[model samples]
Target: MASSFAYDILSNKIETRSAKAGVIGLGYVGLPLAIAIARSGFAVTGFDIDPKKIVSLDAQHSYIDAVANDDLATEMDGGRFSATTDFAGLAACDVIVICVPTPLTKHRDPDLSFVEATSRSIAEHLRAGQLVVLESTTYPGTTDDVVKVILEKTGLKSGTDFFVGFSPEREDPGNQHYHTATIPKVVAGDGPQALALMKGFYGAVVKTVVPVSSNATAEAVKLTENIFRSVNIALVNELKTVYAAMGVDVWEVIEAAKTKPFGYMPFYPGPGLGGHCIPIDPFYLTWKSREYELPTRFIELAGEINSAMPRYVVGKLAEALDMRSGKALSRSRVLVLGLAYKKNVADIRESPSLRLMEIIEERGGKADYHDPHVGEIPSTREYQHLKGRKSVDLTQELLDACDAVLVATDHDNLDYALIANSARLIVDTRNVFARLRLSADHIVKA
Candidate 1:
């Protein structure tokens, strides 16, 4: 079959909402995307390696906060959505989307293992007239050089026998203002035909589709967005430390500075960078830059400053414990607040809270945590010893029992007033108590 004929068939299927869509790795990005695609009138089959997720979807239960049970049930009932663990189902779908993780290795280099594995799996069932889009965040040339090469190994040429594109996911978990469909998608493809198919398909689901020149540009778009954030956040984290030494509140400065409205944008400081993107994405570019022998000094500096935050916050905790409570950190009982990277979200991927706990324990301090959103610490690669620890109840007795409270993540649902009245000493990394107008003599901002 000619490439134009295959493109026409897939393009028609996308236009008439007759396309059978398959989404792989149905976790944070995939599940919501699959739901949105299905809601746009396509029959979407979600794929994942986890049987538990398959079972959960089968029972109309939603593991992600953005996806509600009622909405999931409605989709399932309407026969628009289903999930499975079978890669062979890919052969039956006209549009296959990959939404897998692209994590960093221990040395802070790009780990394309997940993306490579997913591409190989798709290649196993790849056929003509199908459009495969990669929504994973990666370095430039990944879609064209890495994923395209893997798929073409099956003797089918992209933009001919099949179409290939890149549309990096801009998933902001727990953001009230934006969801999968509301966020504008940046799409690019191997060729003009593939680009048109990408725009046509994504245009049906999202509110807007931003068509870029090539797959590399789209990949660069995701990296730039994250790198900009990482850099600005590093600046604030540095300023936070500097202002703390001068006894000036960094939060107040940010509040006043953001009021300018024209020139300034606010990026708040936390214990450290967290979630999947800001902490890891900039490093993808930094690692790639090394291949060309170009320097990424600014990016590397930001990463270093952000990476050292847990230790910095822990140092303040120790100082607060010693000065305010007249106790050594080794003998103190510390309550680390919020396990999630950000507030009100249960995602702990690359969260600095894990690092804070590890540092506290390494210093011989007893570390316990309390998060309203996270019930128990899940298994993570870096923090194996901290795994399985349960979130402690936020009772007055529990607060009083602790020597100090370290506010790593300021979840909205937590009782700030109770913490103010009960805890003997508080090291406020998030400045939550001040934001809520609850102040006490013992509260110290880190």
Candidate 2:
């Protein structure tokens, strides 16, 4: 069949919402997206290497907090969506979207291992009619320079024999305001046919489809949005420390500053950067920029400042415990409130609370955490030794047993009033006790 005929056929399928969609790496970004595509009337097949996730999805169970059980079950019951660990299924897909993770390397460089592996697998199954889109957050030129080269090995030219595009994932876990279907999608493709087919596919699923000039533009857009957040968060985190030394309340200051209708946007300080995007995406650019012999000063500085937050939060706990009960952090029994980076989400990727625990344990502190979302702290590339650490329950008895409580994550499910009146020593990093009348020596905003 001619490539033009294949493109026209894929376009017709997308227009009719009958395109067979295949999603790779069904994690936070991929799972919700697969559901959205299935709901759009496409027979979506999700591809993940993990057998556990494949089984769960096949059984109508959702492991991601953003995807509800009912939503997953609806698609499975209708036979619109299914999951598999097989890469051979890619041969049947008209639209294949890659949503793999682009994490940082051990030395803080951009790690493209997952993306490279996915591209290799897709290359083996490179069919002429397939429109392959990368939704992973990565450096520019990755689709053209990296992925394009791999797929061409199958003797088919991108934009000639097959279609390719770049679309970044914008998934915010626990955010009820926007989701996969509502969040506007940005797409850029290798050529005209690739762009049109990509737009038609996402246009069916999302509320709006934003078309950009090139694949690099779509890739850069994701990095730019995340870098802005990283820099702003670094600014406020630095200010939090400077203002704290001046005996000024930074949280209160931010509450007043955000009242201005123009010229200012508020980004609060936390224990540190958590989640997949904020802490990791900017470095993708940083690694790429180095090849051009240019430096990213703001990104490097932000990482330094944000990375120091765990130690800074731990120091505050030490100070609070000593001043309140003349106890050292080494001997003190400290309880961390939440482990997830964001509230109401079970995702603990690069969570600062885990870093807080790591630092405390290094300093001889008896560290334990209590989070409604996470019962046991799972290991990551950074903290492998923290595995199997179960969450401790928060209670009057538990509070009395602990020498100090560190409010690392202020999950809304927790009763702050009960914790405020009962705890003897509290280091509220999130300002959870800001409205409460805490004693001069009992509570300190870290």
Candidate 3:
């Protein structure tokens, strides 16, 4: 039976205040969710443990380029959206969404520390009639196995006193075709009422809501999408290596196959895999499959091939350098162009570009990177004390000075013409030089 507090709020039909929403972990995923909900006429508060992010949001300055500045200003001005680093404020909200990070541990095990910590905070303020939805991408059973246990510690039974649901976020950072409102959402819950309530809540804002059979199904859908990408990308990468041995251009082969217009989708080769999703999500599935005494052979194989790309690129660079003089990589002045993972934007999380830098240094080459969006990339486990490196201007002087230039990422803002004309040697990993219309003699594809 629904509690009096629940009935009272639901009876009024909460045409407005029924949902005082709270969004936890305001990073790439949560920030957008908070903005979308607030814009849909819900009173929303975004919670983040990072004080700097909280301060920036309080000032109505959007840290993420994906969210429009005008929208942030409007939401802040209307009092519909606000942000905080405090956890106690969660008690005031009717619906709480978890969008925390689910990164891998050092040993590639699933790290649920952030998710666990966030749930404990929510448990501290658990109340009746509230609906909790997890928007993080993780293994199946995480919602029930991880979050629900912590919430029930408050003696509140989920799906009875409260509701629980899983709705994995479909966030593409630099994609232009899809926005939060336009993309169809997948939702699943513990029971019919929980499912209906969530569908009703999200339907008000998004264009479509796809209800799955269960929460585990919804979680599996998210993992399957990423695993497919990992497998396909790895397949094409191996083909690139084999086809190159046969003196065939793999990009040309892909372009020809893509013309089929049916049963064929194109995934290009690169220096290596990157971004938070493609490189990491597949391993999550592989990790969970171990519990069932099952091994994801294809997933592990793809990971091996994809992870070795940086080493492969280094060998290609050495071959390109050998054309000039028969010497090793020592004292080689190599300028790396476009250090971000993909093209157009600056997001370096798990970027293969970072691995490229490390490999270059390990091979006795002095590596320097230039990216328009990223001014500085932090030194991590593999790249400690490699800081203070600024993104240099892609001028003629810089291009002409370097012995060789490697195109790792294809940013649209770069002057590819100047690079083709000026650099003594160029190794193109992204196939970006095709757009430059440069002479064939000046470029080498990896």
Candidate 4:
């Protein structure tokens, strides 16, 4: 098939204003993309296996708090946006985008099952005039190596019979300022024509579109950005531990060092790295590097240091307990504040809070968590032993019952004064206590 056929077919559809667009996996990344494209005057069809999510979206009940409720309602009411669980609806679209989850296995291997399954579905309906863009974060070559192989099943040559590209989702949940329309999108395709068409399409919806050399280069950009974060975070975490031993306040030192305008961008020490991107994305890059006999030592080392932080925090809690009444972690009633990993909202996909809570329990200390956002966490089978400890409402009685309170995350809603006065000992891992005017003896700034 000639490349012009692909371009001509897609151009004809676009000119007719009947160029239907489909998005698979309408979660964080996909929902926003679909809304933006629809708002820009495209008929968008969102597909997800979750019937409940599709139903909610159709009813204009926004599940994610980060997305504006009014915008979702507006899109749905205008007949520009719709969602479905049916795969047959995808065949009717001229362009399809995949934004599914690419999680890791228990052993940290690339779990590409979701991506593979989604690709196969897209391939089933693949036609000569289709533009496919992958927005999931994964290994560098995944767009070219994994997605392309499955897409080729249609016997359609990519960049010729159809267009294909890789454009990583830089969606930062909870950020108020930057959004899908404003954030500069990076995209690359199999060929120059494909790149130009993708650039033109995305440039219509977003503020800026950065075109790279190839699909692989575009995929590598996201991993490199995340790996920089993982390594810098590990460096600061290690320094935090070393400085604590030397009786130095890591928070104060960081405050001082941040004064250097040119040299430093401060990354604070936390109980551990949390969120979907920082903790898990680096491992995917390292896993891919193993195929070429290249070792991602820095990323692997960073993972080691960051993962051990929960154990280190447990040790700090034990030491704080000993200082108060000379009691070991055994029988220590500990209340952990903020189970949602970060502050202000609920999202615990790869939360370090899970491991932190487990370490506390393993050390013979009873642990309970309090988070206004999270009600109940679905426990994996391995954690069935610690089931049924409900997230207590942040009440005075609940706060006073624990022997100590650990501030793993600092949200604005938490009453620090109440926590300071009620709990016997407080271990502040996220520097929550550092910003307070309260007395130092009540809180241990770990």
Candidate 5:
């Protein structure tokens, strides 16, 4: 009876678009989700610990690329969206979504500190008739084990007093074709009432809501998606090494192999895996599987291959410099082109370009970078020393001064023609020059 009454109140609010939604951790995932909920007619309060983000949002400025300034202005101007740092306001919200970071610790273990901390804050203001959903990617049991355990500590039963659900966030930062609203959302809950509320809430916000059997199933769905990519990418990266030895171009091989169209999907090789998902998500499962005494050999192997790519690219760069210019890398200057993990956006989470730069500097080489998207390097857990470094101006004079120009990221806006014409030696890791049909002796494929 308690569950039914609580469900009725929240369900009606969701249906009528009167439910106040609170999204915690306004970042690449939380910010866009908050805007989407606001756009769908819900009054949304965005909660973040960062005061700078609050200041930016108050000024109608957007830090994420997917959200435009005009859209933010429209939402704020309409009084549908607001940002704050206070947890007391959380008590007023009917629905609370957790979208905090779930990064791995230094030991490659699951770091649930952000999620746990967010849960504790919510628990401080948690009340009856409120729904809490976790969108941070993690192991299958996190929704039930970590989040639910923390929330239930308030002496309130989960299904009867409140609700719990899991819906993994599938955010692609630079994807032009897909956005928060268009992507299909996979949702699951702790019980029937929770599931109904999840379906009602997410159904109104996104285009499609896929209901799964359990919260753990929804969690596994996200892990599987990223693991599939990680394994395939490792396969290609290993193939690149084997094919390079036999005078075979892995890019050409992938371009032709993809022509089959029926049995194959192409995954390209890079300096290494970047972004928050591929490099990190697979390890969440690897860490969880240890409880069951299972060996995730394939996933571990894929991680090794992807992690080794930066060093491999550096080795190739050293080889190219010695063969082409007869100069050892220790006494040479190299310009790294592009800094963001992928092309066209300014997301640098777990970017391999940082590792490449670190390795270059460790080997006694002077390294500088130029990125159109990233103006300066921000503080990161792994690459703290590279912080405050600014992007250099890409000019003929700058290019001419370097011993070798290493192509790390393949952004479309870069002046490849200027690079081909000006740089004395080019070691292409992304095949950007060949893709443009530009041929020169100085440009060597790594």
Candidate 6:
């Protein structure tokens, strides 16, 4: 009866759009989520440690391509969305969503510092009759075992004094087809009341809410999706190298295989795995499965191949430079195109492009890069020791000046025609010039 009454009150607040939603960590995931929640008629407050992000959101500017300037202005101007650097400001919020980063440690282990810090902060300000949801991706049992333990230390009982749940963030930055509002939200909670409240909150913002059995179930769902991609991508990358030796184009082969339309899904080959998800998420499970004495061989294998792609690409660069007599990679001036892992985004966390640049520098080769979306490289978690560099302009003179060009990321907006027409040596890792007939004297597919 206590749990039932709690759900009733939470549902009433959500149905009336009177619930105050507070999102911790105003990043690529948090910002869009806050926007969607605000648009759904709830007053949303965004909290972040970075004052720069707070200022940007307050000024009605969006740093993310998925979120537009006009949308930020609408939320801020309409008095539905506001950002803060203070955690104490979340007091009046009925629902608090944690959307902080869950990056891996230097040793490639699960680093839950962000999640732990967020929980501690939330526990500091946790109020009665409020719901707490963790949207940050992490290993299973983190929401129940870790977060629940931390919050209960405040003498507040979960699902009774307060509600707690896990709803994995399904944010795909730069995806034209799906946004936070359109994607189905998967929700689970510690108990019936908490689950119902999670459903009510997310259902108000997103198109649908998929309720699972438990918080751990919801957590595992996210890891499973990324693990599938990571493993498939590794298989494709391994085949890419094998196919190249046999004079077969993996891209062409994929096109024919995908035509079957059933039982086969196509994953592309790239310089390496990049972005926030594939390179990082699967390892979370790998680290956790060890507590059970079980090894995640497929996860480790996929990561091994994906991480080695930069070296593979660098090897190809050396071979490409060898085409010119006396031209060693150690003395080659190479310019890399695109620094973001995927195309048309500014996120460079674990980006293979940077890894490629580092490899070139290590091999005594001069390396520079250009990405229109990313203007200046920031200090990344994985590549902290990496020197920061600004994005170079894709000029004809710049293209012609380099000894060889490596296409690490194939952004659609970039002029491949100009790069192909001007560069003396071209080592295409992403197959950017596949559709276009290139005129470069020496073109090699890595």
Q: How many clashing pairs does model 4 include?
A: 0
lDDT of 1 by residue, 318-361 (tens): 98888887899999899999999988999999989999999999
- Which regions in candidate 1 have their CA more than 4 angstroms from the true location? 1-3
Decide which is better by lDDT, 1 or 6: 1
- TM-score-wise, the better of 4 and 6 is 6
- List model 3 lDDT by residue over 1-446, tens digit each: 34445534632343454578899988778888889988888889999988999888878889886788789989999999999988899999888999998888888888899889999999999898888899888999998888888999999988778778899899888889988887899999877767776787787768899999888899999999888998999999999999999999999999899999799999999999987788888888899999999989999999999999989998998988887656566668788888778887787778887888788888899888899989987665445556667888888999877878888999898888888989988899988888566756869999
Candidate 5: residue 266 Cα off by (Å) = 0.7
Clashing pairs in 2: none
- Give lDDT tens digits, candidate 5, residues 202-242: 99999999999899999999999999999999999999999
What are the lDDT scores of the predictions, listed in order?
A: 0.94, 0.90, 0.85, 0.84, 0.95, 0.89
* lDDT comparing candidate 5 with the true structure: 0.95
RMSD, one per candidate, in order: 1.2, 1.6, 1.9, 2.0, 1.0, 1.4
Which residue segments of model 3 deviate by more than 4 Å? 1-17, 325-327, 379-382
Off by over 4 Å in 5: 1-3
TM-score of 6: 0.97
Sort the candidates on lDDT, descending order. 5, 1, 2, 6, 3, 4
Query: Per-residue lDDT for 119-185 in model 2, tens only?
Result: 9999988888889999999999999888888899899988777899999999999998999999999
Q: Which candidate model has the greater TM-score, 1 or 3?
A: 1
What does candidate 4's lDDT look like per residue over 39-60, in tens digits?
8888999999999998898778
User: Could you tell me every candidate's TM-score relative to the true structure?
Assistant: 0.99, 0.98, 0.96, 0.95, 0.99, 0.97
Per lDDT, the best of the predicted structures is 5
Error of 2 at 321 (Å): 1.4
Q: What's model 4's lDDT at 378?
A: 60
* lDDT of candidate 2 at residue 249, scale 0 to 100: 87
